[model samples]
Target chain A: MTDETMLEEDGHSGGVVKKFLYVNRRAPYGSIYALESLEVVLIGAAFEQDVSLLFLDDGVFQLKKGQDTAMTDMKNFSPTYRALEMYDVEKLYADRESIEQRGLTEDDLIVPVEVLSRDEIKDLMAQQDVVLSF
Target chain B: MKFSVLVNEGPYQHEASDSAYHFTKAALEKGHEIFRVFFYHDGVNNGTRLATPPQDDRNITQRWSALAEQHNLDLVVCVAAAQRRGIIDADEMKRHGKDANNIAPGFRISGLGQLIEAGIQADRLITFGD
Candidate 1:
């Protein structure tokens, strides 16, 4: 479900909803942080909180398409990104500068995410009630 | 003021757990209400009762349990993260058909909703991690 639908269903009508931003700043597979952060996001969705996912630095690689963990012997959980929508977590943002520095484009990602400039991303972060980074 | 603390790293291996513990202590001492302390990722390891550190060092798990007992603080370990890292309570042990449980005192295994709930209920949410 989308955030709009969630707002309508809850009849928010100006009710205060805490905005939580899960900041992903690490690469996937190299450590358990990325995968675990996603787990928290999935669980947080049940509370109907205003949730947004931010991908910055090496974290952007977590959403890259065609991840193969066969050689690394790690379970490839990248596909879970597509399921975020089912949990009403529709606000996905990626840092434009980070992507450009890595020589990647939005086309390289597996999900549809808004690529925001550094200043815009900072503004977004400032608006959140809570920011959890991993 | 109300505060929520998030521990993102385990004990011994990282200072995140210790930092969170001290921070919680100071907050409570200053008359702040701790809504919850949500342990995630490696942080879930802090809830395990099986850790046996050197005699000269501090027992992190015991310290947390004691602090919680004194203040009635909510210490929650993420169930999914705990299950993955072999941290289980009596109920989970029975349900999963495991031999024994290793969750320490003053801590409970719960879902991720608790973390979000902490954020919503508290005036400030502080995270300590690597």
Candidate 2:
């Protein structure tokens, strides 16, 4: 093997871990920021980072069932959101207060998400290495 | 500590913008150095010089200008987003053959790379958006 290849192999003698937390707080399809933030989070997950998604307030609507973007002619990325689990980002959370306020049941969501209390959500935020809220 | 902020919500329209302003103020008070503040999407409107709210309420454009002037803050508006919203700088207006430039002082039009670089260079990247 070439010296460069050998160096490349030995460079990762120890695994490096990256942690990222993305906070979404808007209804899907209303604005581009919500969708763009999701894409960025997925990109982080693809890099083997520890990624967690928190859906707060109106952001919970992003997880709602039966979204139609056909009229807007916008790509329905809500389905792709379910694919986040395959990227090893399974720590999806929905705020209980938000769920209650929005009248959303667990059945109304697309993916399985852990519902968190307000205090629990605060604690979760404190645990993240990087927090990006949109 | 170095910090970067992404303010993607327009002031007066949402509390997110005010929250970001307060957050940055607190960070500065705490001795943290803000590397940049990137306005994207609707946030580009925050950099428009022509915005005139009622005298009773806060003028966000003026506030941002003051903040930028005071701290020498790197206030950036996304060029593409700015143009769509009628917020053009002098150069942009000339380039696009426009009659006017409405971008406020102390803010410059930039690209997504600045946002990425701001995040990479900072110890923390906080976003305030709706």
Candidate 3:
């Protein structure tokens, strides 16, 4: 293919990546879904698209400190979250209502996320190009 | 708006299913269209044909089926997860030498492409998983 044709297709709609918002609402070790959601988010991030992660309810447990999955014989992915920044996927937010309900302070979490109220979370959900919960 | 829902938790075992249900209902009530409901992981159980709940409590399986029926929504269950969990269609039941097919009528067994397509087509792709 010539450079002219390549350029024409390069600027097409298909070449434009889509933005995805992942809403995580569960504890990490309790089920396989949490890890699976992370894998999906990672895959989307790898595609060079906008990928954002929102933590709500028990999903905040994924980012909680002192996660001991060793007893369950599961891989501790608490550290993988630190790599999210390297992927340029830094739009991490947490529902303040969920954190407060669970008695978790921001210090109790390994990842630093901006806290928002329920209304704010709803607003955030509204603005997203796509929202997937896990 | 077109919406896509990802249900990754079981109806009986987790609150994710109910949450997804309500969210979908609300979305539809607001005049939004649900493009697809992708059931992955344990969410495949939502489409099981053999679940029997108590009379007093709401029949979640029926509720899901009814919701889909009312809205004319596309309910998609992932093939890999469904097969892994022993939820199979007639063809799969025969191939695996099973005695019965456990998949419900309204739900269709499909692949990850449904999810990928939903993400592409819907304005929102909300997930309900724990």
Worst 10 residues of 1 chain A by lDDT: A4-13
Q: For model 2, state the Cα shift of residue A43 in Å.
A: 7.3
lDDT by residue for model 1 (B1-130), tens: 9999999899988898999999999999999999999998889999998899999999999999999999999999988778888999998898889999999999998777677778888899999986
Judge candidate 3 at residue B95 and give its lDDT: 69
lDDT of 1 by residue, A4-114 (tens): 122222222134588889999999978988988887787677667789999999999999999999998998999999999998999999999989999999999999999
Off by over 4 Å in 3: A1-13, A16-18, A100-103, B1-37, B46-76, B87-116, B123-130
- Give me the displacement of residue B29 in model 1, in angstroms: 0.6
| Candidate 3, A28-78: lDDT as tens digits | 886776776775565455355667899988999899888887678988988
Chain A (candidate 3) TM-score to true chain A:
0.86
Better of 2 and 3 by DockQ: 3
Question: What local lDDT does model 2 show for residue B114?
Answer: 58
lDDT of each: 0.88, 0.78, 0.78
lDDT for position B90 in model 1: 95
> Model 2's chain B TM-score?
0.96
- In the order shown, the candidates' Cα RMSDs to the true structure are 4.5, 8.0, 8.1
For model 3 the interface RMSD, in Å, equals 10.5
User: Candidate 3: lDDT over CA atoms?
Assistant: 0.78
Off by over 4 Å in 1: A1-16
